[model samples]
Target chain A: MALTLDQRSASRRESRRPAGPRPVRGGQSPLARRQRRIFGPFLAIPLALYLVLFIGPTLYSIYAAFTNWDGINTPTWRGTDNFTALFDDPLFIESFWNTLLILVVVGIGIFVLAFSFMLLLRDMKGKGFVRGVIFLPHIVSPIVLAIFWGFLLRHDGLLNALIVKFGGEPVAWIGPDSAFLMIMIAMVWISTGFYVAILMAGVDRIPGYFYEDASLAGASAWQKLRHITLPLSWDVIGVAAVLWTISSVKVFEFIYAFGASQGQMPPAYEWNAAVFVYGVTFGGATPQYRFGYACASALVMLLLVTGMVALLRRAMRRDAVQF
Target chain B: MTRTGRLRRSISFAALGLSALLAVSACGSPSGPGDSAASGEFTYWSMWQEKEPQAQVIKAAIDSFTKDTGIKVDVQWHGREVMKKLTPSLRTKAAADLVDQSMNQLGNGLSNTGQSADLTSVYNLEVPGEGKKVSDVIPSKYVDYLKDKEGKPFMVPYEVTGEGLWFNAKQLPTEQPQTWDDLVKLLDAAKAKGVSPLALDADNTGVAKYWPLLTLIRAVGPEGMQKLASDRTGAAWDDPNVLDAVTRVEKLVKGGYFAPGYNSGQYPAQQNLWAQNKAAYILQGSWVTSETKTYAAQGFEYSSVQLPPINGGTDAVGVNFFGFGIPKTAANGEAAGKFIAYFLNKSRLEGISTKADNITPRADIPAPAALESLSKSFQEKAVYPSGAALGLKFGGWESTAFQPVAQSLVQGKTSAADFVSQVKAKSIEFWKTQG
Candidate 1:
């Protein structure tokens, strides 16, 4: 596979030809400068495409929020009316609180579970199979997962059938006990696989000597995990957490798929920030489309996500412990 | 510089110019989909998929209209994105000539936002063949529907259906309970038999608990309920009749009338139990028969009974119907109006009964075998404008009144009297905000 062309002498000529390593500035090379200037704008193609296609419509929709446009009528300026109403609206508040709670509780729970699994499976048999099995839900579409889950969670769905047979009462997976918990359960179940994979990848990278040396020094398994494994994997943990916070805030499909359980969205156990914005802005029930309020909700979610990632990153701060 | 350097510069300049031009073109067009119907096609959009049987029936209506008018209807069968995808055109008033939507939800959706046109004048249409007026063809079927008190028909009912409770006869019995006592007694019997008395998903909080709450309210007196909704203030979760309803529901829950884990149970299990011989009753509409036909295949015998009152709702259940209306943005209001009148005709409504397994609201239209017997019973006994009329058609009562009341009942939290109070409070609040 080796090409024997220049060896060391040809490289020296090429290096010397670059005008003693200075950039091809306008002073040095007019042609090179012209080429650089001309090619610069052409590189903006991808960004230009992204801005127009995704960001443009999104911005337009955000703008439409300030007005009362019901899909058919001309947008009438409502100013802060949508936001004012959203503040007073009990439903939005309920959803916001519930979503925030789910993010914190479920987020931590799934991470802990995945990390534990990473430790347990390290020296265990069938490690690859176990990892693959756990990650399967992460690979499946959220919509499909939610639909199937509805059957298990709905009042009369599979859960009730089993409960009735087992002399137990059925639980309302969609509605009463807590829609957030239901959503959290599904989210954790679905997301654990992804976190497990990340943790496992991190675990796999740990140097063998660190563990071998620890064992030779008679360091207990628990002490090695706490002192070495935990410290070494903090970088990966931080990255995983950054992913979780970013993803958790924008969650919609899983919650939506778990259907409102008949108006349990936002105001009841089922609602959160995303669902609140959804029902407020482009919902079927609300005659008044509060596009602006929805934008505000989205803005709030973005801030919360940013704040969380920053806080988590800061909290997980430690010097890199290279082996 | 050298000639070769100048030539390389020229080549580079040309390539760079070409790339910039390409990048500029690659920038988003900032325009939506093309107006496919601008090619002289009468575009009709409906909530239909190709595989649906209902699509075929609706297609027949479109086909019939095309045959009679010599117009080509380009119908786009959209399932979901029709609202989001078609929103731009709908807002810009470049919507379809005829759009398919349910009267209540879509009415509140499109027309409530002031998109659709009032069909009052259209109802004053002439008959297609007999030189008779359209009123003569369909009679007063849609006349009352085409206008609000302000004389604006925001949305019109396309299909007619009656709202009531549906139950499996094996558990609920064919002889529909006439009195509220009778209804409770039946539940008691089912409860004693170790079956769920009612198939109520409290979590849904929209229909199940609310129906009984309304039934109890009507029993106490519609006037008081109406006055309470108009009279009360915040959190009227403590009205006497409403309390009674709540107490009764709580009793039902404590007495094991509702399924255990009822809070978390799926809705279908309640009715499914009836199919599986586990449930006794479910509050539903006539559409349940058509909607639950598959139950028959699953060895379940399902039938519907009117929403009986606490003491035989002297007035009746409620009056909600599927409606038809022309969009204010219709390209040809005249043609669209003609289609509405033509299709909702006696023959057409009757034709719908033959095709789609639903009850026709037309007094003259004959019912099919499935609906024939029930239709006779409804005409003979079921009171009019009670069940469907209970909702706020012009005002906003559907979300506030019925759903909340039902949710309370399912949760076993509010009494019937309290439910009524809640309804009253919601009604008043709705009226205050209502335009």
Candidate 2:
């Protein structure tokens, strides 16, 4: 009777267990518990620290926008005057329009290339090598990257040598007419690797079984990609767009590095909003140091980015399409 | 987290916070401005930018001053971005006693902030460099930049510079251009040979890049460039001589004698044209020697000739001062004055000139062998200050306005007359606020 009871207990345990699913943690917290845990001190400290460091300074900067502090003295209130000047300042307008154009044109151009490369990433030969080369620009310091690019693109630089080899005159890569374009190309080259890697990660997350099942259903490669890859990477693409938008708006190191080194300020196209602000503040013999003006410009940019982030989040919001 | 872990993290964070706070406090600490020389400890700030050796030479000179007089100069060597930092400080009264002359900064920056000391007394006082004593050493043409509007002395002269026609002798046809026409002929030669033409950094540097214009105006005598600076609509642009000078720069660019891309830089724009040998001939300054000897990658036998007279323009180089001034509040003002006097003395000036590779502004100190030789013939033949050149004050914004308009001229989008007229109109507009 005892032996029978022991065998019965073993059989009961076996019956309770289930199969045909991926492994996961058996012990889990309830919704109420998990939500509360996130607010616990361990998480709160780090979250608060980030909020204070990045967000606090940003908020403070916004407040300072309407003030006339020369960076040395305490700030004094001045209403929308700085903003008013920024709009009328012809150079500021040119800089603003130019930067916007760059953000859109280069951002779109790079995204297409970056996404295509991401879809091509699977089973690609020498994938690590390819990724490393593409990603190097994003990893290096902007100063080093800018200096190298400047050397490559100067009139007597290596690019001219290549142009000569191709039977064309040594065109000034940083000339007034072409400076903005070369800058765009360089920026895209530097930034796309990052966007591509992110999209690739999204592509990697889409279960292979989905593609396998689609293939079994006689789906073509194009059909599989259209169905699975695009939908899966949409969120990542949105994020890349938002990031590149902000980055391209305030592009500085490149413009400064590549400004026609000797002559006229590299024809006006290179003057983005940041360059314009800098030129106004510090370009001449005695900097006007219009702190209020600069702060207002920054606030405009900050508000622009904030609005975009909110908009992007809204646009990207959809039921997480579970397969 | 365990109690131990929590304790450790807190301790570490507290330590970091304390360290950061300490760093900030330390950075904020400064000796209050009330040191009235009672302690005799003073900080001497120098706005010099050069390589390590030159800085060391300056340090040695300071040490010599300290040894000769019991006063000290705690020299803080600021680099090239001196104006960016120095200007704000001066506006706020946090400035050093002495500053150097930047390309655009002379007097306007100080006056603009309404903080310029009453320097009238300093100006009227007899300067160390004057007449035969200092004039002989410095190129006489440079004296005008140092003179105030009322012909009173303002900036104390340091290094003298002159704009000359430079060429990569190696790329040239074994002959020096004797006049402005001869140089143009060389550019024509290079274009004919299918090589790069005479390089001109016709980029954006005013007065410097427009050497032909300024020289032509100066050569045209007192009524030339100055009249243009003050006159709207370039009343003088049609002066037959002015037209010739305008045509010279345009002619060179159109002739394709310049490198593939010239007339596109900001400060010292014409420099790159000569440095790269993209243009075979560059009409630039004696400072080219400094640029060439320092950055050897610029590749060339950088040599200069007095810019040839244009049609009948003066065959002369425009020279200017890299000046120094002693602020009255100098903690060691007496010693500072002594140092300034010694620095201007031919012996000490020669010491610095040798190290700086600059032509001494004082007539007493001779230029080093190489510079002396290059400047010799021209120093004999050059014209002094042209009455027509726009008298530049610090904070002058022509640099910003003139560049685009001038570039438009180079591109043939604007006429030389328009550029000249625009300059005059802009000058008037700028002066209105300060007038």
Error of 2 at B171 (Å): 10
Cα distance off (Å), candidate 1, residue B366: 2.1
Worst 10 residues of 1 chain B by lDDT: B28-37
TM-score for candidate 2, residues paired by index: 0.72
In candidate 1, what are the lDDT values of residues A154-193, reduced to their tens digit?
6657877898799986655566556557778888999998
- List per-prediction Cα lDDT, in the order shown: 0.62, 0.59
Give each model a TM-score. 0.79, 0.72
How well is each residue in B134-216 modelled by candidate 1, as lDDT tens digits? 55544253445434556665544545555555565544567777666777888888788877776655555344545554555
Backbone clashes in model 1: 63
Note the DockQ of each predicted structure.
0.29, 0.13
Docking quality class, candidate 1: acceptable
* Model 2 lDDT per residue over B1-435, tens place: 545677789899989999998885554323222222343434556666545545665677677766765666667777645556665554333356555563234443433333333333333333354432333444435655555455544455666666656666556664546677676677677778775765554433333345445555535754455555544444455566665666666665555555555643333434654565545665555766776564433445656666555556555555555555433233333344445554555656676577777776555556765366455644566545422233343223343334455555665455656655665555554434222
Worst 10 residues of 2 chain B by lDDT: B28-37
> Among all windows of ten consecutive residues in candidate 2 chain A, which has the lowest summed lDDT?
A260-269
**DockQ, 0 to 1 scale, candidate 2:** 0.13
DockQ-based class of model 2:
incorrect
Estimate candidate 1's alpha-carbon lDDT, on a 0 to 1 scale.
0.62
